[model samples]
Target: MILRCNTGGTRTDNFAFFIYAFSSLFAIVSPVGGVITFVSLTSDMSLDEKNYLASKSVILACIIALFFAVTGQIILNFFGVSIDSLRVAGGILLFVVAFDMILAKVSRESVTEKEIDISMERSDIWIFPIALPLLTGPGTITTIIVLMGSAVSVLQRGEVIAAILLTFLITGVLFHFSRRIYKFLGYTGMLVFTRLMGLLLAAMAVNFITIGIWNIYLSFQ
Candidate 1:
């Protein structure tokens, strides 16, 4: 007990892991308010298909998260990129998403376009942009990779997984109530909230870049 406390080992490490897991949860799933729209548009699908799509999205997110957890450091090291460099890159990606959110462009034409014939393209929907990248896009992936790097133990990993699953459930509920939220908030209100989130994200980007640079500096010494 005394030795462990002096060494700052597993207990302290698990605490840090929990913090990172929770932080990632907050950052990634903050868009739960938009879920209703997603559900309404896809209501035509059978329960099986809906469940399949949801599972696919969750699986894709988890797979991407796992990949980053395992390969993030090795990939960066092989590419001769420092953690700071990766952070800066991640920051830039977040900035792009944040800018979209701030400008109210996240759901403008791209995601809302339901022009496709539901019968014609239904099968491909779950596997394509929806699951592979759109919902869990670059910003989400980068954040996961960063968190995986910081995760210290099995308990922390379990916490992160729980957080993500909770996010998925929240997303489902949001989808269920999207129409009401949209009506309540209105388009303008949505945009305003998006912009506020964007401002927060921009600040997060600056921190990422600063920390990345600091890590690179430390690596040399």
Candidate 2:
């Protein structure tokens, strides 16, 4: 009976963790925003060309995300920054991003108009705005680092990795069908979705800040 109860509890905890990670990552990545940029950048391209670019961009983004997920902790340790400090800083940054999303403003922290212009001039944008700032920007990187840093066990780490992979896979699908999705959702629907995500992100940011502060306080004892 005890073994069965423990197993059930573990499963529940893992499921909850997965949900939290997925929601946080999805909110940060903002596939709706990606779709808008993807469509704008590839407006003159054929459907096949757009699909190819989407696939390439998504694969590259996944690689970058995974690399950071694996090495983010080490990088932080080398820089002598504690996870708690990172959590507080990342939370503040996310709050700023959420504010921008709520107002339907494009975040200059993620990408700038000048970068977009440069990308427009490039023949291959998969590595430029599309994959870099558009898909895996600093916000996404910080989120991944914080998530990975908080993983205490191998199982928890696996769950975080799974969440990252699943989020990127969904992002790829959304980008691949950007035109169809835009037509279906239209502008108003996209704005509504972005704001909803922003609200969730704001709540998450608060949670992160609370946890970080609590951890820091505990360390003093």
Name the top TM-score candidate. Answer: 2
What do the candidate models score in CA lDDT, each in turn?
0.60, 0.86
Candidate 1 lDDT over 59-137, as tens digits, reads: 6655665666567778878888766677888887777766766776643322434432342355666545454454566
Clash list (residue pairs), candidate 2: none
> TM-score of every model?
0.70, 0.94
Which regions of candidate 2 fall more than 4 Å away from where they truly are? 1-9
For this target, which candidate reaches the highest lDDT against the unseen true structure? 2
Clash number by candidate, in order: 6, 0
**Deviation of model 2 at 74, angstroms:** 0.7
Residues 123-159 of candidate 2: C-alpha lDDT, one tens digit per residue: 8799988889877988899999999887756777888
Those runs of model 1 whose alpha carbons end farther than 4 Å from true positions after fitting are: 1-20, 33-52, 77-80, 107-122, 152-158, 176-186
RMSD of 2: 2.1
Give the Å error, residue 51, model 2: 0.6
